[model samples]
Target chain A: MTDVLSGLEAGFAVALLPLNLALVMGGCFVGTLIGALPGIGPINGVAILLPIAYGLGLPPESALILLAGIYYGAEYGGRISSILLNVPGDAGAVMTTLDGNPMAKRGEAGRALSLSAVASFCGGTAAVILMTLFGPLLASFAVKFNPSNYVALMVFAFASLASLVGKNPIKTLLGAVIGLMLATIGIDANTGVARYDFGVPDLLAGIDFLVVVIGLFGMAELIHLVEQQVTGKFTILPIGKSFVSMADLMATKWTILRSSLIGFFIGVLPGTGASVASAVAYGTEKRLASDGDTFGTGNPKGLAAPEAANNAAAGGAMVPMLTLGIPGSGTTAILLGALLLFNVTPGPMMFQTRPEIAWGLIASMYIGNVALLVINLPLVGLFARMLTIPQRYLIPLIAVLAFIGVYSVVGNPFDLFMIIGLGIFGWVLRKLHFSLAPIILGFVLGGLFEDNLRRALSISGGDWSILVADANSLVLYTLALLVVAVPLVLSRRKRMALDTEA
Target chain B: MADRIFSGLLLLVSIGYGVMAFTVIKAPFQYDPLGPESWPRILSVVSALCCLGLLARPDTERLDLTGKTSTRLVVLLVLLAAYAALFEPLGFVIATLLFCAVLARILGATMGHAMIFGVATGILGFGVGAMILELNLPAGPLRALM
Candidate 1:
């Protein structure tokens, strides 16, 4: 307990510096604007600003503070569009639209918005407290993990991702395989031989993960927006009042608390992000509600459940990345990339070697959550107005931003061509209903997975049985199999039940 | 179905990749028992198996692109390629200005509006890149003025 308190004290000393405070404020403001926009989400927001953050030459803690601020702030901002325009700002906000827009139509926009802010704060604070108490314990446990255990852990992450990411497990697995193949490009680390570089000089350096991320999330999204050309504009509703009544708060306090707990645990699992958490939380709340039939209508509990859950999930997703060196979501994957750029490896040793970056990020999240609530309750009107920006302007601006971001990183034109190629490929994959998150997660994990596998084999003198020789490895392998098997079984049971009903 | 054809092609590619992986030359002095080729070969095999599974259960979902949409997509792609080629020669400002203007027009903007927006974005992009971030963007023909 004393160690955690001292670590937090050191963290506060770093995060409370004037420069860090400014960065936190700037990140939250920019994140809110980006999140409030219709198509520009947290992923795009982070990718577009990543190079800029590097250019600023801020310290690692400050940079992460900024990026982390953008992450949670976007969660707060995504609800604006969902409540006001009935258009979800991002995938995680899709559930919010079920009851949020109806509440707005009934002239309770302010009530819905305020309740969401309060619920978000409650969820974020609860998750942060959990993180403070448990994050160190998890890291200490993971510190004892060896190469064989890491290999099994990576396999478990992959299995969980492939089985749970999308509706089609085969497609998700294919995407992951493609990602792994991409990771094998360029020179092999163990041997000095190039694997798949077709004699091109640029291929010798390998594909930049940032280049792939910008292409898939930023450029592909632009092309999709142009393809849809959705011109249906929404009228802005008036903000009648900006605070939820006492009765309103009392009614949904239990619902918010329940969903926050559910969301945080799910978020700690790799590959399960805010969208899944929010979906499951909202469904659970509906099932447990006294008036379950009022869920899809304008129930205040309906709006609060998803809003609270997603924010809590965003906080919970940090645990795996901070402790296990594996990203829990796409947004966290980019943050992990940022950590690598700062020469900080995120894993068990992070707390021992660099307590400032670990605990500072945790401390700043607490400050940032309060900052978001304080900022969101008042300026939400201004943020919501950002949705009125025309698509013609937004699309071109996003294209240029993506181009500039990718170009500035390597200062090579080949990366530009690579991004465009990846962009087209991503679009095609999206059209086929394949999720992009698994591909990215696979890419990020590919090098680590191979390294651990090879290290384990080398240590065991080429004995493949080392993978399952130990108790930890055996348990992890069993868990991996169960992760894949249970989902298939559950889905099959559901299908059979539907058939029987028919 | 389209998915079946795609999966079949993928299976062939995976097989080709696996075949090529076996051809990697070994170093004069090996560090470990398993060389660099093992992992790639393993991945290729996994990919081939996945492709075979996909081919067996190909999805029937298809995306139908209208002629106009397809043309617009092709034009945008070609323009992007052209912009990349011209980035160094024409400079960041001129090339980006042209790319943004054309892209805006393609997405349904008036000529006047597109040009105005494109020029503003180009100047602002250059300003942020070169002035604020201190990045050495190509000044192209506008080098002397700055």
Candidate 2:
């Protein structure tokens, strides 16, 4: 407890630096704007801004603070579009639209917006408090993991992702394999041999993670925005007075608390994100809340549950990323990649070696959540107005940013074309209903996966059984097996039940 | 249809990658029993099997990219390619101006609006990149003026 407090003190010392504070506020503002934009999510926002963060040459902690601010701020901002436009700004906000749009239709858009903001604040702040307590404990535990244990952990991560993230496990697994393949490009670090360089000079170093991120998320998102423009799905509903009554907050207080806890726990699980958290929280609330019947028709509890849950989940997702070096969600995966880019590997040792980065990020998140609540409540009117920004302008801005972002960071002209190729490939994959998260998680984890496996094998003198020889690894393997098998069995049983009912 | 084709292509890629891992990749000395080729080999095999799974369970998802949307995507691709190709030579300002203007025009902005937005973004973006961020974006022919 003293350690956490002292660490937080040191963290505040760093986080309260003028520059860091500005970055947190700036990132939250930008994040909210990005989140408020239709058809963009936290992943896209982070990916788009990552290069700029890199190009700015900010110190690692400040950069992370900025990015982290954007992350949860998007959680706050996603509700804006959900409430006003009836279009989810991000995946996590989908549940928000159910009651949010209904509230908008009923001319209580203001009440919905303000209520969601308060719920998000409650969720985000509660999750941060939980993270502050649990993060160090988790890291201390994870510090004991051996190489083989890490391999099993990686497997568990992959299995969880494949089973939990998307509809088809095959596609998720395949996407991961593809990501691993991408990681295998360029010279082998262990041996001085090039594996899949294709005789290209640029391929010698492998594809940069920034390039992949910008291409897959940023550029592809631009293409998707263009598609949305073509489809003509853009519309905005008029918002009335923007304030939440005290009664509404009191009525939904329990719902917010329950959803926040649910969201945080779900967020802590590797491979799950805000989307799952909000969905689960919404589902649980519908069963437990008093006005369950009005869930889809503008119940304040319905809006509060998802909003609170998603923000808490966003905070929850950070615990694993900062502790185990395993990201809990797609956005966290990108953040992990960012940490790697800064040459600061996130793991158990991070607290000891780079406590400033760890605790400073935590402190900044604390400030950022408050900043988001303070900024979002009143400025929501302005953020909701962002939906009116024509895609023609927004599209070019994003496209230009992608191009400039890549060129500036890498300074390699070749990466420009590479991003385009990757963008097209990513767009195709998205069209095929494959989740992009696993690919990134796989890519980020690929190096660690190969390194640990090789080290374990070396230690065992080529004996493969050493991978499961230890209790930790065995437990991890069992968990991995359970993660993979349970979902398949349950889905099959559901199908069977459906067949019988039919 | 798209799923099958993509998976088939993926299968080919895996096979090709595996063959290269076996035939082309070589280590001069081995400190460990498993060499560099082993991990790639394992990855390729897993990838091949996954590709097979995808091929077997070809999803019925369809992409409706016909009409003006498809044309815009293609044109945007070309513009992006041009932007990249001209980035270093034409400089960030010139390349961005042209690309942004054309892309804005394609996306339905008036010609005047496109040009104004393009020029503003180019100059402002250059200022932000070179002056603010201190990025090494090529100045090209605009070097003398700056």
TM-scores of all models? 0.97, 0.98
Superposed model 1: Cα runs more than 4 Å off:
A235-238, A499-502
What are the per-residue Cα lDDT tens digits for candidate 1 across B3-103?
Answer: 78778888887887788787753555786757877787898899898888888887755777899888878887898899889988888899989998998
- lDDT over C-alpha atoms for residue A423 of model 1: 88
Chain B structural similarity as TM-score, candidate 1:
0.92
| Candidate 1, chain A: TM-score against the reference | 0.97
Per-residue lDDT tens digits for candidate 2, residues A1-502, read 9999999999999999999999999999999999999888899999999998988889999999999998888878989888888888777999999998998888888899999999999999999999999999999999999999999999998888888888888999999998898998988899878878878999999899999999999988887777768436466787777579999999999999999999999899888899989999999999997679989999999999999999999999999999999999999999999999999999999998999999999999999989998988878889988999888989999988898889889999999999999999888888899888889888888888999999999999999999989999999889989988987899899999999999
DockQ score for candidate 2: 0.77
Model 2 residue A472 lDDT score: 93
Second chain only: TM-score per model? 0.92, 0.95
Model 1 chain A worst lDDT run, 10 consecutive residues? A230-239
